[model samples]
Target: MSDYDQSPNYQRGLNLVKEMLGDRFLAGLTASAESGAFAADCASIAIESAFGAVWSRPGLARRDRSLVTLGILIASGKSAELRNHVRAGLNNGLGVEELQEVMIQAFPYCGFPCVAEAIEATIAVLRERGLIDDSTQSAKERGLL
Candidate 1:
């Protein structure tokens, strides 16, 4: 076992990440850490800080936090992270309509291109989960079609 394996903060973070993301994704991260391809310390810090410290904070609910995260990720064009958060958002009780509204709200501030890219990423996730059909309904609803 790694030295950080038994650390309270790391364990808490890991548990929180598992709750938010699921075992398979967390296992991938753990595998990366164990292989030394990705530094365990970095993973530990991210889990502890991002999940345990930040995400575990009070005031904002997990669903709301996911919304905020989605907006920022969209604006920043962080498609990969956006994909993860889109799933996280849905798991946290954000519906497809809510997520679409989030993208719509970001359109002005993030610009058409950014919002469009974000929508594409969101659609891919929704389709993967079988939550949506291949129609352009979402884009039309958002005034993008």
Candidate 2:
């Protein structure tokens, strides 16, 4: 609290996000939570206050943010993170096709190998979440047939 420029409530929320996402990414996003960059402020504001306040504002839904963030991470070749955001995307309202589009868009730069592994990861996530009857079923469900 005090004059640390961060509220107790905000810091607690950031800490909770750290628990959910773990140190590696929280570090990645916040630059080790050391610097005072936008990421740090994002850790301070977005994850903490805005996440509870402005992000939850009346307009865009959390699902929308997840989908957009998923696309960004995928395009950036953050395959390790694709599954989490992909799963969140599905939960938030994305379907197989939407997820596929995200992967495909990354192909020009990320290449087939990354996209291939991304497909596998995403399919397994969907299957685990029961979003698809099976991996192949996704195409049929989307009429990609």
Candidate 3:
């Protein structure tokens, strides 16, 4: 095992990540680590620092943090990470409407293309969780007769 695996912060992060994102993510990390891939080291640092230290902080609730993360990810065009956080956001108690509002809120700051990409990612996750149907209406389509 790596020294990181021994740290209390790493353990805390691992547990929190499991609670937030489930076992598949950790399994991917483990597989990468076992393969001795460089990305594994980066993932370890994120797990220990981002998840363990920052996410474990007391000032913001996980749901609030998820919201903040979604905004930043959308602005940065981090679609892959955005997908993961979309799932985490739902797990953290963000409702479908709240998630949609977040994407809408980002549209002005992040622009249409960025927000559109985020919306697509969010929609995919929502569909995966069966939160929305395949025929789910678009925003404009929802209100018009």
Which candidate achieves the best lDDT against the true structure? 3
Which residue pairs in candidate 2 collide? none
Q: With candidate 1 superimposed using the best TM-score fit, by how many Å does residue 10's alpha carbon deviate from the native?
A: 1.7
In the range 1-145, model 1's lDDT, one tens digit per residue, is 5666566766777887788788998998777656766577677677767886788888899999999999999989998889999998988999999998998899889998788878888988898899988675555466774
Q: In model 2, which regions exceed 4 Å deviation?
A: 1-60, 135-145
* TM agreement with the true structure for every prediction: 0.86, 0.53, 0.90
Give stretches of model 1 more than 4 Å off. Answer: 1-4, 137-145
For model 3, what is the alpha-carbon lDDT of residue 125?
87
Per-residue lDDT tens digits of candidate 3, residues 1-145? 5777778888898988998899998788757755668787877877788988999999999999999999999999987889999999989999999998998899889998788778777877888899999797553354431
Best-fitting candidate, scored by TM-score: 3
Each candidate: how many clashes? 0, 0, 0
lDDT pick, better of 1 and 2: 1
Q: Cα-based RMSD of the predictions, in order?
A: 3.3, 7.7, 3.8
Model 2 clash tally, residue pairs:
0
Give the TM-score ranking, best first.
Answer: 3, 1, 2
Would you list the C-alpha lDDT of every candidate in the order shown?
0.83, 0.63, 0.85
Worst 10 residues of 1 by lDDT: 136-145
